[model samples]
Target: EAGVAQSPRYKIIEKRQSVAFWCNPISGHATLYWYQQILGQGPKLLIQFQNNGVVDDSQLPKDRFSAERLKGVDSTLKIQPAKLEDSAVYLCASSRGQGNINEQFFGPGTRLTVL
Candidate 1:
């Protein structure tokens, strides 16, 4: 049994540049989530997907941040014209279903640094 997978564990870029992160959830997991965690703060939910359909994305910044779960398996998160404030860890998680009892498993996360 394998866990979630993420790419480019660390990234650094200028404030105006763009950056993208990738994630592959565990097999048979029906729900996927993306979160943003700033230093000293708890992770914030950015987006969620149930299978290939988007379940929630209200917290996602449409102006610069976007994410998608393709075919209900792999996912990608991108930030365009990144801001200094966007420096944080992007976390990917997955669960079997939508319920409080369902345990969500998280990936290692991608650390982004904007200069």
Candidate 2:
């Protein structure tokens, strides 16, 4: 199976600029997730979608971030008017399901640098 795909791999932007990242889940997978990983910290789930409907997004910063899954396939995450603290790795991941046999597969990530 083909692994997850991401773009740019790296991004550098000044404070208050908007940015967006994309993700495509594994074929036949029904669950997708977006996470923010700060330096020296574990990945924090920003949002989760179970086939186009959001299952969880409590951790997402609604003021600056928004996400969507179109056609229940690929997804995109956007950060508007970013802050200096937003410099971190934005990781996209997907899982077949919440079942015991399912495992989350992560993409390489898009590293954003705010200067």
Candidate 3:
């Protein structure tokens, strides 16, 4: 089985600039999630999607962050007017379903640096 794929392994941008990250999950996975991991901290879930519909986005900063899994296969996360505090590794993960015991596969994150 193939793993998830993300683009632009690293990025640097000035404060208030905009950036976007792309993700391609494993084929057949029905649940996708985006997470933010700061240095020295655990990953925090930003949004969850089941198919093309959003399941949870309460932790996502709507004012700056937005994400979508348009075809239930690929996803994109964008941050406009990014702040310094938004610097982190954006991780994309996927699972077979919404079941409790599903194992998640994560991609190499896109690391963002805000200057």
Q: Assess each prediction's global lDDT (C-alpha) against the native.
A: 0.94, 0.92, 0.96
Per-residue CA lDDT of model 1 for 31-64, tens digit only, reads 9999999999999999999998998999999999
Which sequence of candidate numbers ranks them by TM-score, best first?
A: 3, 1, 2
Off by over 4 Å in 2: none
Misplaced by over 4 Å in model 1 are: none
Q: Estimate each model's TM-score.
A: 0.97, 0.95, 0.98
Candidate maximizing TM-score? 3
Q: Backbone clashes per model, in order?
A: 0, 0, 0
Top candidate by lDDT: 3
Candidate 3 local lDDT, residue 97: 92
Error of 3 at 14 (Å): 0.6
RMSD of each: 0.7, 1.0, 0.6
Q: Give lDDT for model 3.
A: 0.96
